[model samples]
Target: MILPFILVLALFDFDNVLLWTHEISLVSHKIWFCDAIDIFYYLNTRLFLLFFYFYCLLPPSTQPQRKNSNSKMATLAKLLSSICVCVIVMLTTKAVEATPTYTATHCTNTTTYAPNSTFQTNLDILLYYFSNNISQSNGYFLGITGFNSVNAVGGLFLCRGDVATTVCNQCLTTAIKEIRQHCPNQTEALIWYDECLVHYTNRYFAVDKIDPRVNLNDGNIVSSVDLGRFNQSLHGLLNDLATEASGSSESKKFAAGEVVVTESMTVYGLMQCTNDLTNSECGTCLKNAIGTIPNGKQGARALLPSCNVRYQLYPFFTSSSPSSSGGMKLGPGTIAVVVVVPIFFLIILFLGCYYFKRRSKKKILLPSIMENFGDEFPTLESLQFNLATLEAATNQFSLANKIGSGGFGEVYKGVLLDSRQIAVKKLSKTSGQGTIEFKNEIVLIAKLQHRNLVTLYGFCSEEQEKMLVYEYVLNKSLDYFLFDPHKERVLSWRERYNIIGGIARGIHYLHDQSRLKVIHRDLKPSNILLDKNMNPKISDFGMAKMIDIDEHQGNTKRIAGTYGYMSSEYAMHGHYSEKSDVFSFGVIIIEIISAKRNALSLHSLDFDDLLSYAWKNWRDEKSLEILDSNIEKSYSYIEVIRCIQIGLLCVQQNPDDRPTMERIVSYLSNVSVELPLPQEPGGFMGNRTNQIPRDNISDQRNNSNTTGSSVNDITMNNSFPR
Candidate 1:
């Protein structure tokens, strides 16, 4: 591979690499012939190379070798030898070090346009615009040209999201000029390059398929001993990229990141979608693409028309670029898929072959890592209950049995034949989780066990009726007690204090103790259920993120969870971390000690939020004043003040300043531990709505305390939650 690449490098003079040759010279003539076959000669054209070698080997007959009068002929022969060397070196270089590897080309052979015809002329015009129009300073362009339906044509070019505008323009120009040469008179054509793709047809896309995927492994192998770890890290990285990238907009729907797979290796990955697909559409396409990435290899990638994804052991992306892409592919099924000829000095290396995946299905399901666990997951028989058993327990999912409802579906209180009470969570048919992803999450959640975390008893998957069975807690949820005036008394000072400790411990376990590091993205009062003793048990693993244990932060455009509880960094920007969870814990702690529902800590003249009011009093050296008046007799003033200080520490404006759960637990256990001074927190989030995403923003209603206010308060479950 190294030698061949070096040869190709020697063959091309970069000065003339882009310059086209019309008249024939040894170099020009050979290049012209090779290009007609393909700019890259369809990647190593065996037949053409064999013929060229034989033709060039045969000596020019009857040469005037010894005649002084024929000195010009000998000089010409010497020049010819130099040209052949250059071409051979160029061929090797073409394979080795070229940028923008070609994936595939799709042409609709269903129709053709005659040379010099009106349609052909329109296509030429469209192609001209795609290659020449680069002044906008972005890497995407779309246009259509033609007077009548018969001569009409449309075209669009997409450069890799992470590429420089200059690189983008160069790739587009080459793709535009070459697609025509490869497909010739085809009425509709598409060409793919690592840097860019040019697609043009008379009709615009309506229903896009996730099919004709391209899969490539860079021929590097992972050892058997390290294969399992490699696959696990790769899968987690790909899924994270998909979730992050899918939240992006159409102009540059892509993401790039790296994850450490082994002690010595870090895998880099990039995912991208075409500029036309919806956010959900992009997600589905990326999920499908991620599922197909090659396994047990040092490098791999999968490409689709709607989205593309790739990963390599050695870093392959520009860390500075917003997104980067690479992979190999060639597949069959489409009528006019063209493998371009090699001679076109502009030829790109074909990275891999393609396999057909039809887009006829109505619903797009998430792909494999979560879709199929295979042997790694425990069998469902031991964890599944029949529909009849659950139906009888919940009385046919009756409203009387229904305890709560969230974005996912309804949760019901049920009893098993053994008299064991259970929480039956019926998943909505339209929920984003498919059967495979649902089951996968269930398995992962079941493995996690802590007294403060809700327990998954089992599951019920009878056709479309998917459900999760959790151990039923008698006290309902934290919000029911914390928010309702009549019920608030039951949560005495001791119970509230214990609940705070338990919540912190549970989150700590999730972040550090569990085999898989899970980030409970939606952490709030409604999702925290209490057992008979009022012990807090966190619920809802549906929208939880199970990331690489080493990963510390994640970002997404589709923000889940209640707005008020979300950390400012997470709410305004899509960034979250274990510290984000600490921020929510801070809010809960303050709410408990103050007996003030989160929406309004206390109705003051200033209309300050819970955090702001608490911060003000604490800054004035009145920390004990923030405590709930109702707990006057039962609460320890010193302990309550300490809790307030911790709460303020957790909700600090800077996430880095917030204490970790481990430290919070330590603070709660040891009374003498000195705490840091608290700073004023961010104001009520009402005015900053513009920065947050409108989609997936959840909260049942605005706060009754702040009427006509723009605050996102009175939260409800808005995602897959129990």
Candidate 2:
């Protein structure tokens, strides 16, 4: 009995002493040991002690004062022994119960390695290999029997002896799956199962070294009253554990101990390393781990080079007495020599490299192109153009030089000193427009470089002044002839067809082919300027959107566009798309064919709007009746019908039903293609009071003035002379 008691004490002392050593080493390293190894060590030692004590007290012959005692005393002793045995058995049973389980029959394995590799690529391969080799019939037996070693290098190993083999295998399998999933790219990784151990590495890992980088910190904050004392005690305890754990032998390099805080409370600690490490290496590892703790933290832990250390406010390990047969033995003066020197050098090297790399990469100045602009539209260098040079170019804003007038100002035709003819748009002094409009015109037009679009020459912005210069157009615009009666005779059918095609191509470029897909929200006849060759150039992209290809439509409440040409979706619902431009183009096409305005009037000799007139004519197969009188003699009947059909197709009620620019161009080029019937046009049933807004009135007037020579009567406007 005494021998067993002594053995139990020695075993307890061995673990306790190791734990003390680890605690001391942890304090030195400023690291905590709240890792898995520390938890396992603490639990294993307590359970062993409790089991040992109960086992020693079990035999009747071993009991003291057995023969001299009365029957009652003997009976009482027997009952006490039985109860102790039962308690120990129950504890062992519960410990096994606490461990997780795995069924070997469910284990699956697959080959994941390449033909040349020695190691398996994943956990499935390992399982497959074991399953095929170990069990041919009912799978491998489970419970404790499942954990025995099959091979020296790669075999099943159990950390908890009481765990069932089925449970151990299950735990190991789960751990293996988790590690593979989380760390798929890593060549080496490890995971701990409650009942078993699963680890794989590219190279063999030393089982004894507790890697110090993986320390765990308790998340709970320490209370102010006990913070200082708890920290001090924790530090002292962890350092001691680290020192003792590092000095442990090959069979076991683990320890558990406790330190009293108040009368009822004690802080328990545990420390450990893998058994493969040398005593010196273990000590060094623990010493490094101990130095990581700060002053006021509670429930801390550290994983060291050779061991791990942990301290907690409650006892988290199972308690059992140790067996009488064996206890670990250590030589005298072994602990002190194993710990001191190597730990001091590693700390110095780690901190130096961390701070040096952070200071080398940072920025200083802006790049060159942005610096030359002076962050404004008109720089000091650009304002150098003299007022005399401007006066000479514009002929002192003479009536002959004046081309047009707008809400903002009057436009004048000018010839620069270099003989470059330019259209100078000089702002009126009382103009409500501001510098923002000037900037917008400059920025928007300068970036647009399409062949069918007008080019911006330059701008003058000096001394509260603003002016925009553009390339001069010889023929005023399409509206000058298209909207006029007698002058419409000059525009042949061929010329009108050419103008329509040019406008479509220009709009196509704006909607898709340009660098930015733009929606020209305000396309009108006036906005289409005619060049010397009479080719139509679409202009005024100030209200255009640079849309992404993936986006379908956008909405805005701040509407800015001409009224008759605007799509119903855009006008009523605030939605705009590339198809909105298609709708506008349809209106333009009808206007070009009929040579008439879109406004509603009783004396117009047609329905309210061009869309309604066209739709009614097409349904009655009298589309050619709406053709302009000037082009009636020259236009082909088939071609006219084709144009009318296309116009109706473009004005479909549904935006999606409208043909894309590519499709429209194809339809126009191929006269034999069959066309689908048109649906009811948008805005077909609106109230008469809801006329296209006044903002759009200017666009109509401008169109009439520009195209007056080709459509309307050739009354020479005072703005620009032929």
Candidate 3:
């Protein structure tokens, strides 16, 4: 895709054009170490063509396969969303700094391998693979290296989905370089960061491990007169995000928003999981993270490997729109012109070449691919419906029948001959493009029969199309109304409360009572489909891997997210369980209440936290948006993410969220208690009200305990001296 562009640059005497072309020519053959990935990684993508061309030229082998992929349209939405904002990040050049903030590392001293041994050699190979071969397009990678099972090593790297590509690359580079240094000759090393997380082992690494996390807090409890109300607001925000984030695309398991406690005070929070994780895995990780938020603290964080959750009085996460301080956001139209047109042109350019030669795209028949699945693939026999039947039921999914659309796909209202009402979700994808493995293991979701959960009747997988059939809910999605400013009637407070209870009931059934014990990973308003009585029915079972089952794909296992308040054993050896859903549940309720209060300019920044940036004034004015009539010093929502913007540079998290490693993160949070406080405030550092810029924030109230805590963090997995 970029070869033509490179040739054009060659005539103009661009210094690197000739060199890049020679490398691109090798793609027809098996290749290793292509410069295309690098050129794209560090390349400033202001000229949208450059970004489009890079992906167009990206080797098919390097492109990530879809996990729990429902349809192609949803995937394309995620791709475009990330690419457009990443273009903004590349232009700003701020997300390139700081990054890969260190949280904790676990090295298995008990399982040490001698120098130059087979195990050590395997570990080296695994690290090498991570540094050069991981996909920059995604924040998560899982791979294993070994000639034999006796000495194999497995590793995974996951950057916060919001961070820029450069930040992800840099974070991986650091993890690869220092992980060994941190635990020489150890058989295991699990290093977690604010912006990203990395872990590898010569032993087992399952899809979920909630353990050995670092719990940290500013130790300043909210001394407000209504502490309970403040907590309710905070919990309400996170809980909603947890539900929402779990339902997010597989490529991004993250959600953030703020809860307004009063005109002068607000609570900002975020929940995230590694993209490799299933919906249940992400929700569980976030739940655990939220559970340990150290109730009543002015600020708190649950930092772990599977998922992470945090909340602060001031802005701790990045909101939309650039602050006066750093970074910049481009309007959607500008992004379209910059990123879309070039892509459209490139598609045409490739099509012409393909028609003259042969069909450039290869189509894989669904039936043929299904034959390759082993016995482990669940029986789709009775649960599988034919594509033609669905088309007939939905009238070929005509516009009149189309009830809704999203990144996921179109929801068409359908009626069967038996007068049965249904909703047909059609997801399209290109055959022979990207990994095409269908997660048949998810058949359990169809068995999830509950009153609060939308029943999954069956599925249809055909050429270029994957469809899910569900019991139709007449009221549409909760967000369809919650986020619409022009909706005529407002939801009654009692209705809102009932909706929350109904959602809780659905999740409770999935987690504790349903025949299939699963987690409804995406629990946000959009996935909460309301029925006739305004009772909530959770749809889109983005839930997780089945419990007590050993799944194997290649030599690796899926991995993800983190948070704190871990047991000593759990802390020493990373293993976690379900988090209290209370914290995450709190935020959604607040959004339900303040649906009309989200008219901030920052919303134009295009990040997805629906109830965001309302607290832009809280960063500096300390929620004095009312008391301080002058509004002189109040800044915007620039707390951005992963807590290391103070100890670490600003790049480890999503570039869209962070300004270019600004010296001042804001007066929202100070994470000096965990990481070394940077002298220059080298990255983002927002503090709370009544808090100062003094460097002693990291010096915990109990100095003696703090030092030991930091030291023990490194050897948490029983690597410490007895």
Candidate 4:
């Protein structure tokens, strides 16, 4: 028994040393045990130890000495060893199978298919031509062979020296066959193999097409703490590889390099391009691919037009020769596993039992916390209000108290028992808004307090009733003066400009200055409420998102916003960013200066969008023509032109070109600063109007009323020029 235990311990000790070294290899290089086939090896060793233990347990003294008995035991041992060998073989096979394969196949020619007839015919002709070229050993180099035929359009080619010529031919043949089946009549297709690449396309995709690349790495990073440096090194190396690959000759468009991260860690990278591209084209394609990597991570793979590149801290490729540095040296911590495994197993079992014992007690304690939360937040406890008290407070939600009504709810002016005047927003149970939105509004708004943002007062909830209280804004919204004909006269260029500046400041606060960077996806004139002092306060955080400061953009399937103010990128692609809000601000600035809705304005002779119309007028030095007729006389032409230019700058088609809130604030405040020319605004009035329903306007109004209930009859009129 003692000998068996010692034998088992010795086997475990050997594996423990291997495990420790493997772990050190992983840690120092930021790889993993499973990543390097170490786990599989360790498991196989453990199984061998188990076999030895059973073998040693047999009673040798009582064993029969007959040849038949001895032969039987020998046969049994051989069978057991054979089983272990099989397991090891399967594990190794799996590791080999994990590597990606590429193949191409031939299609049978039929009278139905003709060259340049259909997209598929064109693609087939291209693939067949390339396959024949590779098979015939044509002297024509990759890019040099194809100026006249479809091959001139460009394709990918990968060659490995170790692979046999027959293997390469077979792989390409299989790839062509598979591509035809998978892509069917598609004009473009690509298939990968270990030895070769097969691709055919009708379109002129020879330009940098980096999309559709696969990224496969160990899902877990080796050291989360060193991620920043690792990512930086990875990006730097990738950029270099892209440059080298792109600059390679048409004969062999490939580049490989290794980056030393530390004394023990080295990251290897390989970049390869289709041998068809010119040096310049290859470089451009690879650069585009490199640009797509998400910042702040380890290990990435990208596909480029002429090349594909991958980088990892560990060596993924297998080599016939032993590495001079040794695969990866193991660390001491990994070696300790020999002694630590049994102890760890026992500790885990004990902890599991203790966890179950504690879990029972947690069940009893959870309800108490829930009850206390409900009692502390009275607003959440009730969903109904006394009809009589609401009626008495707002004179039965009388016409005098009525502020606004929309799809989901209504708003009315009310005075609470504490003598505080407030606006009451009552949401209908059957309204389009759901409970999640209602709760989201309450939670998000309660914690946000900005001078430019509306203040949420206490709320009242009773059976089937949801009401929100807000501080009353006596001056109404910017739309009151912005869209009215006669009322527009009250908004002098000064006040309109000030309002524009104030609104920008408010949005800037929500996006950057606040603790949470919020994107007000539904920013519009109506959402900009004004206090008695004519100071603008951005209302409605219900549709807002609290984003990480580092995040530049996000996507959502549900696109909610007023049509004209929404950016094209947001409307069409479901993508939104701070730049989306900037786009809206651009529209608002133009509306403030012109006192006209982008959707309703008919001043320009040729352009359909306010942004395009303004751009045309500015270029023609007739920008004053697009300004509000009422403000043109009172406002300085220079200031009006400047604001128009800034507005156009804010609504540029490219989000990257649009200034951040910080930049916008600086530009608006500094009159002498130079601004770049703006691109055509995307999602201009023409596209937006086509997609938004007429009822969406009414729905938005209702959403606001339901969200802001305390203000009574808030209307934009000539009487209120905030």
Best by lDDT: 1
Instruction: Kindly indicate the candidate among 1 and 2 with the higher lDDT.
Output: 1
C-alpha positional error of residue 424 in candidate 2 after TM-score superposition, expressed in Å: 1.2
lDDT of 2 by residue, 1-722 (tens): 47655644554454353232122122233322233233334444544455466556555744674664566454444444443444344335434333344312211132233431223312233433334333221212111111122211232322333334455455554655565565454444444433444444433444444441445667777788776777677777777766666765535566677887666556888766545567877676666666655455557766432345567777644333332222333344433223322223223323433333222221112222133233643433343344544555566667766777654566787655344567777666554332334555666566667767877777765444567777877777666677755453367777777787878887787677766677877676767777877887776554666678677678877565655666777766678898888887887888888888664431233334678878888898888878988777798777778777777777777899998877787777777778787886764223453344544222222223432111111123432311
How far off is model 1, as Cα RMSD?
Answer: 28.1
- lDDT by residue for model 3 over 246-359, one digit each (tens)? 889656788888888987778888888767778987787787777777778877877776677777777645465432322234466755554565456446544544443332
- Which residue runs of candidate 2 sit more than 4 Å off their true CA positions? 1-388, 432-437, 485-489, 600-607, 684-722
lDDT of 1 by residue, 383-478 (tens): 878887787566667666677564456678765544466888777777653343366458677779889898888887665588888887777678
Clash counts for the predictions, in order:
30, 89, 62, 40
Model 3 scores worst on lDDT over the 10 consecutive residues at 713-722
Residue 487 Cα positional deviation in candidate 2, in Å, after optimal superposition: 3.2
Ranking by TM-score: 1, 4, 2, 3
Which residue runs of candidate 4 sit more than 4 Å off their true CA positions? 1-392, 434-436, 485-489, 600-607, 684-722
TM-score, prediction 4: 0.43
If scored against the real structure, what TM-score would every candidate get? 0.45, 0.43, 0.34, 0.43
Candidate 1 Cα deviation (angstroms), residue 617: 0.6
